[model samples]
Target: MRVTVLLAAAAVVVTAPRWLPARVVALRRKVFEKVNGDNVITFPNAAVGPDRFQEVYSHPAANGRSRGAGLSDLFWYWLSPGPEVHQEHLEAGPRYDDVARTTRALLSGPADALSAAAARCAARVLDETVTGRVTLVRLRDLMMPVWAEYFYELVFGEPCPREARDLIVGHADDVVSALKCTGLRHPARRARLTRYLARRVAAGDVRHPLPATLTPTEQVHYLQGTFYNTGVVQMSDAMAHLLLALAQHPDVAARLADDPADDRYFTRVLDETMRLYPLFGIAHRITTAEIELDERTTLPEGSVLCFSYPDYHASGHARPDVFDPERWEHTPVRESHHIPFGVAANRPCPAWRLSPLALRAATGEVLRRFTLHSTVAHTRSLPNRGACLLVRVGEPLPPRRLARIGALLRVRDRWEHVWRSVVQLVLGTVMVLHARRLRLAGRYFDPRPTAGCRVDQPPSSQENTA
Candidate 1:
């Protein structure tokens, strides 16, 4: 009967998404509200992506060498068409400007911005088709220069910190220069590299804001573009945490064999886990345009700083020393309380509803099919504001192994029919044992966000990687 029930449960997990309900989107947003970002109600940002990238390729002067117009091209994870975006900008010429301007009007900022973005986008596209590798150094070179020359100087419009400027520019350059070409063999690593660089560029300092004349909608869209990599990286980190968590839980076999989302098991895990670790948490921006934070920090045009997320989430610590989630049970649910995603209004997390729901389905699959027992207690840390996790798994072992174990196999023929019941008993006991372990050991802990990043780290750093 237990085996029959397990089989049935597995079937349910596979079919649940079609039945997950549309209202789940609202639920997702609500959770994002509680643990993802700042609760400020604002319009959506980041509306201009595809067109923004297309502009540079449009002009004869806009050759694919350096990104001439748009800064948004770094967002694309895929390959581009040229050696450099600048080459395309030159090739594109006036036609480039016309199309770029048109795109910018819709996307945010100015047409020139879109054109620049498009040129970079084209360069990437062309480079991929030609060299089949991305120019990581170029990405950093472009972004850092923009921030240093334009973003810092213009937005700051005051005495900027020479140290901060040096740190940001130098580190960006280091990251880019450190990049080496990886060929077809290391496709996965290449993709990871792409994401890492893109995140840095997207989340890195901006050289300037949209001209004061732009509408609110345009401003929001531009901010959205700025956070592209931030969102992507966060999602990636969260997923890594979930995978590690599954490795620690032994009964993952049953969950994998039969998905848990069907039975609300995955849902429960997702709710707790997402709260604990958010991937895209925290944000920082220049207050040049003039906004409010509080009494301690006032209006300084280009002061580089960030909103705290790790500290906010961990605020309910058991003690100054011990980190415990149980303590947070008493803590009221609040918007800025966590923020593994950004806290700002316009830059609200786009994948808020998307991530948890996906987590449920994906995690449910993982738990049902594998026997992931934690041999070690994995401790998450963000020394560099990114997830560098280490853990071990016992592998395809567990209740399923019972049927494969010779000793556990029932006797054959007539005897087999009689002993089959005994085999069943053995299997059930093993499943229960695995289940118990998963519950007792916090091996299945989710990735929670934390505050604090070194001068070399991004502000929203966390083991809370998506």
Candidate 2:
């Protein structure tokens, strides 16, 4: 009896990798829903489906960003030190306009110059880090330094000092780590970058003039939050996804490497990579007025609409789960259900034009230097941060050795997720509650502007109620 009990316990332990993570993820979702409340409605639900996803997202009434949702507080907390000044969170007003204009000015430049900058930054990072024939790395971490330097150049119009690069990378990594729920946020780490930006602004080291409407402090916050925080983090994640896809699909990688100037094929691969592993999971918006789905169905004002990018991208395609760049050869991007960047009718990604050019150039540099390979799950959240092996161009690994490395990575990632999911549940719940207590978004919007429409209140029957 004792031997049988011991054997059973051992069996459970051995098989835990295959089962534990999924259960934890389900439990984590439940905890998240409970903490965030039930005031939210999801797209692709019973009433709304894929066909109306773009319609709901592009609706004029669905414009409120920071008000009416409990989730906003969590975002604000994660992006603190100046969440109020962050362009994306601000309400539609003069302040948002000014922020938008400044962002445009910062991003505006020759496409070739942007591409060259990305390649230069990527080459520097590769030279410093890739010292071995077979280098194991977290793709996101490997990409972060390159973007840290790239964005630093964009902001200050000079090569990034090592000190500034380190600070920016640390801050962006912390923000994304907390966002993925793989790690808790370190406020001190983020504050270090904030202080550096503050000092730079004070010294008048910024190459471009910031929005004049904002205070000096807000100006510092704008630089840190917009360019340093979001810019570095998102670009790193995007490169990671793109590189990992190339690593897994060696056929595509070999083709691109052989013909490095194949911009058309590279563009297709980028689009398909984004579709399979979209950067954003769910983007939430608050309705400022009643949205009539049809004559019979109407969404009440102040309703929270959670748009699921994954679901929408998954729909309206044959085998949408597969990564097939060839599909784009026939169908135009405008005609497809793909929206890697958000809808054009709404506040689309500010970096939409420059992002592809930069990514293509950076990826070109990476491919030129190394042949990438990976055998791990590629999810949108990228909780594992894309475990990959980079082989120097002329030094290819034997198949047996490559298989061994892949096996080790697979086992390691599975075990890591078991613990990671638990951390996410615990820390994610705590942060949500803490954000609620702080009431960051709640207080920010409490003054209730009387201009166009109120997002805090529900539409009354006398008004335009459903």
Candidate with the greatest lDDT versus the true structure? 2
What RMSD, rounded to one decimal, does every model reach? 23.7, 5.7
* TM-score of model 2 (CA atoms): 0.95
Question: Which regions of candidate 2 are displaced past 4 Å?
Answer: 448-466
TM-scores of the candidates in the order shown: 0.34, 0.95
lDDT of 2 by residue, 284-374 (tens): 8999999999888898999988999999888888999998999898989988889999999889999999999999999999999899989
Which lDDT tens digits does candidate 1 get at residues 405-463? 32322122223222332333343334333323322111111133224533321122111
Give each model's clash number.
Answer: 71, 0
**Against the true structure, candidate 2 has what lDDT?**
0.87
Instruction: List per-prediction Cα lDDT, in the order shown.
Output: 0.32, 0.87
Task: State the lDDT at 48 in candidate 2.
Answer: 83
Best by TM-score: 2
Model 1 RMSD in angstroms: 23.7
TM-score of decoy 1: 0.34
